[model samples]
Target: MTTTSPHPSRTTSPPHLEVTWTDPVTGRKGYVVIDRLVRGVASGGLRMREGCTLDEVRGLAAGMTRKEALHYDPGNRYIPLGGAKGGIDCSPHDPAADAVLGRFLEAVGALLKHHWTTGEDLGLRQDTLDRVLAGLGVESSVEAVYPLLEDPAGARRRLADAFAVDVDGIPLPDLVGGLGVAESALTALDRLGIPRTSARAVVQGFGSMGGATARYLARAGVRVVALVDALGVVANPDGLDVEELLRTRDALGGIDRSRLRPGDTEADGDTWLDVECEVLVPAAVSYCVHPRDQARITARVIAEAANMPVLPEAEAALHARGVLVLPDFVANSATNAWWWWTLFGDIGADATEAERKVRDAMRRLTSDMLVRAENLGITPREAALVVVDRRLAAIEERFGGPGAHAAARREGSRP
Candidate 1:
């Protein structure tokens, strides 16, 4: 279904620019939402999926803006990037998907020149990205292929070999993002006086971020008790075996049903919310935790691995219920990954070292942020916004005092 009207109550100010394009060849539609730009530059992911709507893209773009803006450095120094997101309302299974993506890219080529950079998201893949870029002959026009494309090192080598051009380090968005989320959850638990070793957790997705998050949390001494995906929700009171689940899970986040244990049972989607656990991780989609869903949440903490997984009203309800919510932008960890890669460079030559570096960075950042929020007696979401506003103010000072930035973000000015 098309979104004829935008969500009037956005988490942030309206985006600076919203451009919609219709592919003349396939009659498909695409959109690029630029929430705001830090000195005429912004970056986020590109998601291609059936039923993807403009408002969803707008929300994701705004989340990216907050994620980028929330980078906290000791010296008040960090790479400042604005938030942007692109999406095409189409299925990945369509035979003409490549052509549609190519056409959509071409239509938005002008805006992508240097203003907004995009990476990969939910329904998009690396091979599809390569095909689209090859068709457009605009390889340099792209930025990073993040959450959707994990093997940055291999992708970099392949591109350099094909074009004989130097390629820099490619950031592993999912791995680092997952690591960060796991770290944030543990930090939240610590702040709440919950013992890490005895904490139980339930994850709401089993794809890239969800699966990785489960594994990391398990390793950190948290019992991953349940997992939910498109197929169905599976629960194991004794705690699910994450490693075996990973081995048996399909690319679509479905389990082979045949591999289920006799005690394992399939349940409805909200089964996770009803599971008695100390930590609840919404790692799949936006608006999963609505007002009605709050009554089912038994967990003391909700660490958002997905962007905007909890609606604003739901968050308020969660707060009223004495639940500590680690906001999406803060918990997702993509922000930390971006900050580390852009500032510190490569952590080590191997994956183990890379994970260690991610864990360290996330632990420090999450710990400090959570403690500060607790001391201030404010929600983590409010604390995060304060941090974002501070950074944006710094950018304004550096950019010769913000001119029309305020005007461009007005709702009536969006186009």
Candidate 2:
């Protein structure tokens, strides 16, 4: 399906394609939205949740566009792909969840073959998705982009090797996004004239992203005061044991109470906003911070590790109150960019290389965005959008528009 908007420019245009799939056996619904297509393929992740909708997937796909465009560098080997996202309307804990996912993948096999490349997202695990794909005889969730590779075999090997490499018992792929978040948070703190050693942080999730962010921030001398998960808030005024908490997390990100330290206290999850800290990382769900929630936030900066964590009005309110919101696209873009950088040979499978690239890029991007925001007298999200717009235009000018490749293929010509 396409959008009904009258003014269909690149940014305002409806998705290039949208598919709603219903699992035959379980009757579960799944959605795929391709917001834009660069070189005939779009990239995003597949999320499973209880009430996942097309509109949510569409928003995520659009965010993916901005995330991809925000990382565009003229000299980099990893040209940004278009934006796409898939979501299934079923809880990951449901007994039929895997079957629903398998059926959805089978239904969208054609798109996966050539147009949409995906991986894990909220409520989904990469290993589970990979297992499902393997059972379906699919080579990889990223197989759709293989045709664009200079050396598909080498690219595949590099990504596989990178995924196999673990840092502090966490896989490399899981650490990169949180690494970016930590860098973005640190940059924001630096810009605000705050020292990392003097700052405190409360992260609202203990999953892959939040766990990694807390670990890195603690290592960087930021006192990680609290962590909120499905259970509730785990707090330690003098800084929780981040590595212990990380080691004790379940697959679904819930903390194992058996591992809590004596000084740590548990509280209601909603009290996360009340935590006194210099940085708050909302690394779990989207639209978590509404207008009312904004007033409760005491943090100097909010680094969004989750996509669309803060509502626009809440962000505006926070901005009015001098809270710096490092936008999601700018702050949490490292994971997607890292995947491409490694696959395209801009970086290697080594942890140090990934760390260096993510740190450098995030610092630069956050600094640039903040500077732009100040110059334009706007919020950081607006500034990041401005950057995305300019980069997207440049990408289009050099590579042509979304349909360029398809048009070329139809005319029996190379794109």
Candidate 3:
């Protein structure tokens, strides 16, 4: 079998997981990052890319566990599908990659009796997921299992439903991520003393995450001066017509460059980053703005809509420059929220009720973290550590301490 590179996040040895795949004939490797399997079953997406690794899968799986918390907090107690993420080190263009993916899915499907479900991410597209699931004859999928719950973004439940639905058996919902980003932006805006309605923003990425966020920001009266996709970026000082652009955007988040006049633009794909606006939303892929590009960022508040889109060093640099930095984990709370409601249908109330819950949860999370940062005179990340410490103490008291106090307190409280 072809030897895969070890996960960067892992040491020489860490843990042994049950699910693994390596085809000898083709020499390919596929893996599952089983983060947590609380309710018997574990579910997550399968990413296919040239450099996919076990370590990333591990982290993504764990993130799914936390995401479940945001969604299925109370009524949906048992996070049924323990979180897991699979990865194949084959980019979309490689024929060998597709073969590896199919075989890997079939190989992994052998254990589907364990209630393992899969979704789409990275190089794995919806159609590819279908091919894999179909060949493997896997049923009782995760997307179908996403319980109908209300969404806070007005399109909340549907967002969850849409994300959970395997567009050909591959789920790609990041509404939770988007919501968290908006929350972070809001926090930054409040910090900058800018009203949401008064802020002009630029959005990068036309995928569901970027598209939905841009629409929400516009709805909230944030003028998006520019937007970009894989093909290129676009700008309009008079306020780019989002609707018209969406009409022209391709499925891969492309903007028609045929209508563009060059020279006035900085870069196509990175256009949104250079927009002369108060806020910049990097809702697409990772490292769109690296350290070298940080100086070009015109936005006072850079809200990360994608996971760890900015490098850690760059993030620190941004903070030092007095640009408010919103950590991805804190900003992207929608994962757990969507996961929970999609599983249990929110016994608390209807979709609206469920949405309110998500907002309250996120608002509390962002606000509390920001408040802590302000109070301690530290970055939000540091303040998050404080929040985590207190939460751990609470968990210890409730579940482990001799005088454990897991009792629910009144709304809006700590301890």
Alpha carbon lDDT at 29, candidate 1: 86
Q: How accurate is candidate 2 locally (lDDT)?
A: 0.89
What are the per-residue Cα lDDT tens digits for candidate 1 across 120-186?
6777765567667777777643433221124545445543343332112222444566778888898
Question: 135-242 in candidate 2: lDDT tens per residue?
Answer: 999999999888788788999999999999998888999899999999999999999999999999999998888988998999999999999999789999899999
Ranking by TM-score: 2, 1, 3
lDDT of 3 by residue, 1-415 (tens): 1112111111111222535567766666677766544333456667776766665666666544433432333234323334566777667678677667767776766445454556656666556677666666754335323222122333334444545443222233434445456666776788678888778888888665676567656666778777777656677665656655555666666766655544324365644566688888877665456888787887888776665577767777887887766655556656545554444444232344444555666677777767877788777766765554454333434344322211221111122
**Model 3 alpha-carbon drift over 4 Å, by segment:** 1-20, 23-28, 36-43, 65-83, 93-98, 110-117, 125-131, 143-180, 257-266, 270-272, 347-357, 385-415
lDDT: worst 10-residue window of model 3: 3-12
Q: List clashing residue pairs in candidate 2.
A: none
Query: 2 or 3, which is superior by TM-score?
Result: 2
**Residue 149: error of model 1 in Å?**
22
Of 2 and 3, the candidate ahead on lDDT is 2
Backbone clash numbers for all candidates listed: 0, 0, 22
